[model samples]
Target: MFWLPLLIVAWVATGLSCTRLCLTAYRAARPGATPGQGHELTLYEAAFLSGGPTRVTDLTLVSMARARRLLLAHTGWATVVDPVGGDDMERSVLGAIGPGGQSPIAPVRRAAAGTDAMRALADRLVTAGLALPEGTWSGVAGAVRQVRAAAAAVIALGAVALLMPAQESRGEAHVALWFTLALALNAGCLAVARFEIHPYPRWASPAGQLLLSALPARGGSDLTAVAVRGTRALSDPELRAAFAHQDTAHRSH
Candidate 1:
């Protein structure tokens, strides 16, 4: 009966993790107020829906750089050429770059993404039903991760149960068979969750995802490519190098 305690713990973990995942998924898929009625997403909006605030910041930087309004050096510094921002996002980026007109791209991206303008953009998308509220996608993703951890814990517990001393009547094989049932439960739950909710969205809701999918395929413009595929879509090698350098620097921190 010593293995019974471990079995209880395994089942408890499985139940809690799976329940959290299911709830998170259900909340994420719930309908928003005033669903969008063929509302067209602007490039900025599209970028946000497709990849969240960081993507919006990336698109803005790329567009400004391409238009010669901003200079993106291969060394990861951004220089303001035009001095005037065309929109709120651009203004936020400019503000992040500071009045001196030059700043590192990594800090600029992070700063801009947390600006009031970005929050307003998220609010607009949520109101329009094209995007989920902030953190919904993150919640689902977190829940999924918890479930994965639970699955691993179940496997470990099962192994421990099999390794423990057997009772007078029960054998190691018998204990393993019982623990296998718990393992099967964990496996089945994980499999179902993967099938139904794998590849969780980073920001967009189901509606936003649909809108993103419906966007025209990338073609004919560097801005369009950046809007869809992010900074890597920039055709300018220096710009690509600049962003890559920024990413490397940011990760190093």
Candidate 2:
């Protein structure tokens, strides 16, 4: 009897939390009544939507290096070969590179992501419904972890109930078994969440993802494709290495 209230409260609270988050994310992703404008997202926009600002930054660096406007050294430093930016995004990338036209690529990336222009681009993408709301992925992931932790807590509560000094009763045994049911339900919730989120991109809205997938694959003659497609798509080992090293340095933090 003592443990019943505890078990009911814990399971109910966790269930409600998970359900609410799942519903909110789903509603946010669902297409609107009027539908999207079917706008063709540019490569940089696609990269930003799919992988966030980091992907766009990497693509920009790679594109500049390929065009001989920037020298991406084996040592991970980016030296600007061209001080004149052709457009606003290029100017932002160049500015992030610095007035001296040389700095470590990692810092350039951080600086670029923080730029006012970059923030504006992000706002445009969200307004167009091409990008996920900021923090959605992390929030969903956190909810999953919270539910799993609640499952564990429920088990602990059940164990404590079983170990308490009391007259042996079927009612007490039922309460513990009920905890097992709660654990099983938690497992089901986790499975569903995983399935739902696996196809959901980190920064792109579901509509954006669909369009990105339907876009023509990068071709040999598409100069713009290389920048938007990302550094991983590059054939140059050194360029990929520079980006890889930067990625590693970030992960270590």
Candidate 3:
């Protein structure tokens, strides 16, 4: 019975240590943010370029053609003067690209940006189920930095809590304290990587503009105009729906 408190302390300490270690390792493996991040054109970019917003039915063949041109331009490839006839762009001379797809071009390889403020640009593309085919890590360094910062903050807070004189008198408190710290650290790391850091600026602006422009135009006139002049292009049904929804919702509000 005398060992009960000691056992609890040990269990908590072990759990905390293991959890913190695992969390740290997992976060470390994650692709974080870096500096000088850029991206190729995508289907969503096509939609935005062709028109401001569009509905499901608006994505006709002409719209797609315009998107193709924009995509080629944005990617620094020879602009497609005319629309590609068939659906499959992957097998074309430009090389295959789709949602979460990669490019054969080395420079376009996915990499992280420098700041936490810009990480969301890539995050949006990633969440949209799109990426460069090669899966190169960009923006990861920045993301790592942000994650480290948050994790350190959490750890520091835990340290401070443990150092409090009032808390020291309690038995098994050290284990509980560490466990709390570990959890906080893990949460902070995740929060920083997923939310804080991103590839584009947080606000809608030039950086955001260029990144968004990379998406293939699948929507309407506003996006089509851009697509007609971009370097690369792609098309996706779901992304069109999302843009349409966002536009409609914005209009309603």
Q: Which wins on lDDT, candidate 2 or candidate 3?
A: 2
Residue pairs clashing in model 2 are none
Q: Flag the better candidate by TM-score, 2 or 3.
A: 2
Task: State the displacement of the C-alpha of residue 77, model 1, in Å, after optimal TM-score superposition.
Answer: 0.9
After superposing candidate 1 on the true structure, give the runs of residues whose Cα lies further than 4 Å from its correct spot.
Answer: 31-37, 168-170, 217-220
Would you list the C-alpha lDDT of every candidate in the order shown?
0.81, 0.73, 0.38
Error of 1 at 185 (Å): 2.2
Decide which is better by TM-score, 1 or 3.
Answer: 1
Number of the predicted model whose lDDT against the real structure is largest: 1
Off by over 4 Å in 3: 1-133, 136-170, 198-253
Q: Per-residue lDDT of 1-253 in model 1, one digit per residue for the tens?
A: 7888998898888889888888888877765554546666688988888778888888988888879999999999999999889888889999989999999988887788889999999998888777887777778888878878887887898888777888747588787776677667767766776676567666677777776776664333667667767888777899899999989988999
Model 2: runs farther than 4 Å from truth?
32-38, 165-168, 216-229, 251-253
> Against the true structure, what is every candidate's RMSD?
2.2, 2.8, 14.2
List model 2 lDDT by residue over 112-225, tens digit each.
898877788788887777777777777776677777787788788778877765444676667667788887887777777667766545677776677777665534333345
Q: Considering lDDT, which of the candidate structures 1 and 3 is the better prediction for this target?
A: 1
Deviation of model 3 at 249, angstroms: 24
> Per model, how many backbone clashes are there?
0, 0, 75
